[model samples]
Target chain A: MLSIVKRILGQMKNDKRSLGLLLFAPLLVLTLLFFILSDSSYVPKLAVYDMSEKFVAELENHATVSEETEKPEAADYLEDNEIDALIWSDSAGTHIELLEKNSKSAVALEAIQDTNKALQPTQKELIIDYVYESTGDNQLDSLSFVFLGVISFFFVFILSGMSFVRERFGQTLERMLMTPIRRIDVIGGYTLGYGLLAAVQSVVIILYAVYVLQLQVEGSVALCTLVMILMAFSAVSVGALVSIFANNELQLVQFIPVIIIPQIFFSGLIPIDTIPFGLGNLCYLTPIYYGCTALEMIMIQGKGVVEIWPWLAGSVVFIGVLFLANVTALKKYRRL
Target chain B: MKIEVCEVNKSFKQQQVLNQISLTIAGGRIFCLLGASGSGKTTLLRIMMGAIPADGGSVTVGGIAVPNRQLLAEMGYMPQNEALYEELSAWENLKFFAGLQRQSRKTFAADAEALLEIVDMAACKNKLIRDCSGGMKKRISLAVALIHKPKLLVLDEPTVGVDPVLRRKIWLYLRQLRNEGTTIVVTTHVMDEVTQCDDAALLRNGHIIARDTVKNLIAQTPDGNIEELFFIDNQSEAEAPLC
Candidate 1:
């Protein structure tokens, strides 16, 4: 074991560039996410034309409302989506013609709803008009977290797995095997090394999505990081195991859709509950299911580690199984 | 210590690679397994190195059975493939192998340099292995195999692709090691290399068709050359097996 540790340290020393990339790549991505995602305030520009004081006040309360002196100016504003909703009253029971510039129609829809409630006391049936999406819900932006979780796991798993496969293909694995090293030593060394890298990556991505990109993360940052690390471990182990079945780089790449896509389907990115029961059971077997579940609990529900331990435990077990599988698979070459 | 193989046989699915092969190698002697490309010489070496188990019979090395961990530590194996990491320098590769063998740091640096010098690669020690030529990579791999200083050295086609001058230098080093009581077992298809061995095992179709000193094998054959004896044995085996 001492020799194994020393060998692992030596490998790290030799491949310093890979080590640096593993540590700092995620930090750089997280910083970019921070700058791009944070401060996403939806200040919808509104245009009001020939509207009563009461109607204008209702629109102003819900959005950044502006008054248009000419019909052409209001038409231009509507065409450009400068005004999310326009209120123009000329005896047609105070018509509230809402114009949406952006597809995120929830805020504009909410503004229309608020205006209708205020007009209700006057016994006037305000006509609500929309240029697009008549029955669209205003909760679409809330789904970004699910996609973020999927993307994070995808990149981490592929990078970790490919790096490991490269080692095997390059014959470095054979060199390590020729030593007096145990099979367990190889698996443990790779897991610890890549696990450290993936953990840092997960933290950077999560923190960037939360603090930098300003995504809606209602849960504890620490819990999120913990869940991310667990997810990273699952990816790293799966990647290592997959490399065993692959003879070369091309074969390793062929596994992406077969191995990774199935995980995405089960990872709660899409509603797997709506699928058939037989197929849904298959989703439960995917590591991404548990990872995405834990991520959702921590990010959306603000769940603590105690609440998310079962999913975390599932990921840990999956990682452990994959690691053991890798060690056993290596026996095809060296028995010990 | 003596290494003995008793009627070992191995097959890959339906294709038999080795058949009823037996030999005994004494310590402080140089033994070469000479054969053609598909003669199973490397397979025999792997069995001795405990990398693969034989389908039939058993092998005992240093009084212990094959695949024993303690025995494995006392034996060094250099595989046919270049196994060092291409991204790392030759020095870095040696450091890693030495560490794995649990060599002391104080001796590791000087010993690694000496081994590189022996391989005529001391000048390119710090260059990335990926940048080195095929011969340089092979030399570094040989140095790594010798890092542990094992009593028994098993080399599988180590001199292939190496220039004639360098090959001779490597053989000279092996001879020096043999003088120091290190038992060397090398596999090669080159007919000329068989003359250098104290004892040679000529394998054909995975069987030890002839096992004796080069002079004895030559005297037994119609032609005096070791290559002629190998061809005669191989041709007879091919015809008999088909019939």
Candidate 2:
């Protein structure tokens, strides 16, 4: 056991790049998440022209509403980027016209809704015109969580698996085996090393998505971290276990589509109901299904630990079973 | 009192790699298992090292049966391939293997350095194995195998790709180990190396066709050299058994 620690430390000392990836990759990724989530603020500018003094006051309260003198000039004001929406009051009640520019229609629609509420009981109809989404409403934040889960699983799986497989093909595994070290020691060392690496990666990616990317993390960050760590554990174990079947590094990479893609399909990235019954149950069998589902529940739906524990539990079980399989597979060289 | 094998037979599916073969090697003796490729010489060595079990036979090392862990602990094995980690420096590789043997840090540090010196690779101990020459890698592998200073040493064609000068040096080291009560088992197809063995076993098609001292085998075959004796034995095997 002491030897395993020494060996792991020796290996880490020798491979600076892997060590760096293991220690700082999560921090780098988390920093990226911070920047992406926190940088954007929605403070849409608005201009009101020919509005009743009461309506103008309401608009000014909700947004940066400027009073314009002319209707024709209101269009000019919107084009000049002075406001995101325009309101013109006439005999047909207070007609709210939204400006179209390098602005989001959802933001414009939201502004219109707020204006209508502020002018309630006045019977003013809110007019919303979007340059885009004229056919149907589109969600900008849709599927961002799913995409995040996919990217996180991919990087964790490939990097972890490739590193483990290289140790085998490079004959480092055989050299280590020649020692009096137990089989469990090798498995434990790799699991702890890569497990720690994947945990940090998950934290970085999740934190970046929430705080940096500004993706709506409606649930607790602690729960998200828990799910990420579980998912990483599953991924690292699966990666290392699958590595045993691979004869070379290229063979290890070839497993990505087979091993990783199925998880994306089953992990709630796609609607499970849309899949055929036989195939839908296959998703239940994949670790990613549980991981992504838990992530989505926490990050998108704001669900807590009690709601997502089953999925988390399933992922933990998968990791444990795969770890055992990895240890068993190594018995081909030395039994017991 | 070193190694004993009785009627060992091994087969891979329909093909037999080791026929009924038996031999005993005394402690502190250099025994060379001589054979061409596919002669099952390596199989015999592997069985003795407890790397593989014989299909039908018993191998006893010291007094215990083959495949015993305790016996294996006392044996140093150098595979045909230089199985050192390519990414690690020679010193690091030695340190890892020595640690596996449960050797203390201070004890193995000096032993590893001494073995490196013996292999004439002390200067390049810190260099990664991938950056080393083929001969240097082989020498380093030998150093690692001997790091634990096992009582019995098994080398599988340790001098295959080595130059003559280095090969001679390796043989000298084997002899030195043998003189120090370390029973050495080596496999070779090089006929000249056969003469240096205290006893030689000529294996062909998994059968021990000849087992005796090199001088006795040469005397019986009317050839002063092992190369001639090898050819004579192969020619006789090609012909039918005389009535």
Instruction: Please give the C-alpha DockQ score of model 2.
Output: 0.26
Off by over 4 Å in 1: A1-149, A167-170, B220-224, B233-243
What stretches of model 2 exceed 4 Å from their correct place?
A1-9, A16-149, A159-175, A207-214, B218-223, B233-243
- Candidates in order: C-alpha RMSD to true structure: 6.8, 8.5
Docking class of 2: acceptable
Estimate, for each residue in A115-217, the C-alpha lDDT of model 1 and write its tens digit: 7787787777668864322131213224444555566666667766776777677656765776677889878877777677677777777766666556666
lDDT of 2 by residue, B57-131 (tens): 888889788666566567777877788776688998888778777777778878988898888899999998879
How well is each residue in A62-173 modelled by candidate 2, as lDDT tens digits? 6676776757555666677756777676777866565553445456557667766866867767688643221211131345556666666777777778877877665456
lDDT of each: 0.75, 0.74
Clashing pairs in 1: A34-A212, A34-A213, A37-A213, A38-A213, A38-A214, A81-A101
